[model samples]
Target: KEPGSGFWLKWLGAPSCQRGSYAFYKSVSSRAQPDGPVQVWRLGEFYFIRCGPQDPVCIAEVTLLWEDQTQRHLLASTRLYFLPEDTPKGRTREHGEDEVLAVSRKMVVRVEDLVRWSCGQPAGWSSSLKLNGLRKPPQSSDSNDKNTTTNTTDKNGPVERQGVKVLSYPQYCRFRSLQRRLQDGARGPGLQDPHLLALGAVRALPNTRVMYCRDTFNHPTLESNTNFSWQFSEYLWSSQQISFRPSACIPFPLFV
Candidate 1:
């Protein structure tokens, strides 16, 4: 039997094959049930067998018998997991859990986190394909308004911000000052001091004065004042911290 010859029918008592060429054979478990010989054959990746009335052979029925056995074997060996038949109508479970992982309210998961988690799986393994179209963050309305209102009627057009533009002396001076300040912090801001919070221009919250004094200075004055120490610790720890790196280019734009 040449490979890719399609079907092998030697077991049908065809003269083309020698006696022992067929790998599968017919057999009965008991003698009480007298039945005709069952035809058996192995073709490519599958094994097939068929048995029925011996006279006026029905080839269609024999083919169907082989198909039924193949289907039965396939279904028995395969494992399929489906949502529980009794799950409540509105309920859902999260993926990969016996019960779906569901949220009653709207939820957002970060793209970076999701990519890191599913880097190697097939497309179907994803939670939903609808969310795959990359969406950009909405541009700030204020910024859009500023661009739209820029005067474009005059030949000079008030020296439009885009394309070649002229800068006033004060604007040039301010730019120079900002350039100098950025140069001074080339390694980026450290995590300590009034300099630390002020360099980043972080907005201060209530009780920040006391908390900043305690944590930034580690003042000895708090030692004699036991009552303030506990409260100071709590306040200091509760503050949200931001860590940023100075970049030659805007990093977030590159990702989008």
Candidate 2:
């Protein structure tokens, strides 16, 4: 929460993801204390933040600290702008509305990490999906083993890997949909809301932050089948299997 703000901030992190604890700092640098005496609370995989009256109006930094004392890293160093009042004059959307990523993105797990987490569970489709891209090809395993040993030395010391794993477009969408449905439960009909889950991951290549299964292309196949029929053409087709046959010979009278 920002200082003098009427509403609290919610962190929308991924479900079932356990990465690390996070804290928000008001100062630009880590050495300075946090603004407004921020308090962090964890419930399951989600974390919530609250600040006292003394907090700063704009937060400058956010830090992610591992449970182990040996590791503490800065997740993001960005300015979080906030509105001074609860009400908006013209636009209802506040400035700091998109800050949900400060937490939820952490739930994205690696293939190896997912395997470790799902160990001992009954083998099925979910297990197979988790191992989709991660399974090493038998032919490449020998060469990969040798290369792994040779590349073990890190010139800059061992660093924790970050960023999302690469997957084909279709595979990524399917994996995201399944992960979200499993985490947030099926919504509406059969897991209709693909984006219902609050989880998200950083995408490769372009390196954009994307919600799992968020098909921005707006393709027909990716859309959910809603029960409600609003279009007149849809009603005619579904109920009568007949479309309006426009007769060029038929004349219509219009009042001027």
Candidate 3:
């Protein structure tokens, strides 16, 4: 969210990222008058935020947290999630209650927008995709470690990870199909996609906001896939993917 000044006023200069807990976000869990054992915001953790009165509670992953030097506050960059019902092809009995479609980019949010940390069993895939280097790297066992492992039972059995993970392997297909679908649904199927306007000629529309997303270019969310780097044009679908592509009415800036 921005103020009426027509430019970003709070985050004035290049910000620095914190290591462990980052700065205090103080979600619903840590709202007590004194300190409590609430989990602080960390990279890769999933959280829920209600952006407005009528906006549905959406879930997202914390990608990065930077402290604005001028205003002395922490702001977050995230990858948004969408529910099965919100997708282009609506929901069905096959979708799990916890299932979601993940996406990235378009805005930087205030840490205050976070409502609560989403901690529970994550939706599973037939053959789990590693999503290896997107956020955390695979851990190698250390020589000093013991062979014993812990078990967490919830009437089902033990699980590996505890939160939602992004699955954007086929996102170019989603984005291209969605762009066509959105146009077809609005103006009938045979219509073409809207014309492309140069960055200078573009104007901010009614519901859009002015954003600066260049800062996160050096982030993992923007990292290129390792496997399909040098492929031919026809085989580019797997390589031409975007990190985040959800089935939600995502608020995006026309000019950013």
The candidate that wins on lDDT is 3
Task: State candidate 1's TM-score.
Answer: 0.14
User: How do the residues 52-135 of candidate 3 rate in per-residue lDDT, one tens digit apiece?
Assistant: 444444456665445443554445556666565654456678654435654433334555444223333333321242221111
Ranking by TM-score: 3, 2, 1
Q: Estimate each model's TM-score.
A: 0.14, 0.16, 0.35
TM-score of 2: 0.16
After superposition, candidate 3 runs with Cα above 4 Å error: 1-31, 87-89, 92-99, 116-162, 169-256
lDDT of 2 by residue, 65-155 (tens): 1121123322221112122231122223442221211211112111111111211112221232232221111122342221111211133
**Which of candidates 1 and 3 reaches a greater TM-score?**
3
Candidate 2: how large is its RMSD?
24.3
lDDT of 2: 0.23
Error of 1 at 164 (Å): 3.7
How many steric overlaps are in each model, in order? 4, 3, 3
Where in model 2 is the C-alpha error above 4 Å?
Answer: 1-52, 56-63, 67-81, 84-256
Worst 10-residue lDDT window, candidate 2: 41-50
- Ranking 1 against 3 by lDDT, winner: 3
The candidate with the higher TM-score, 1 or 2, is 2
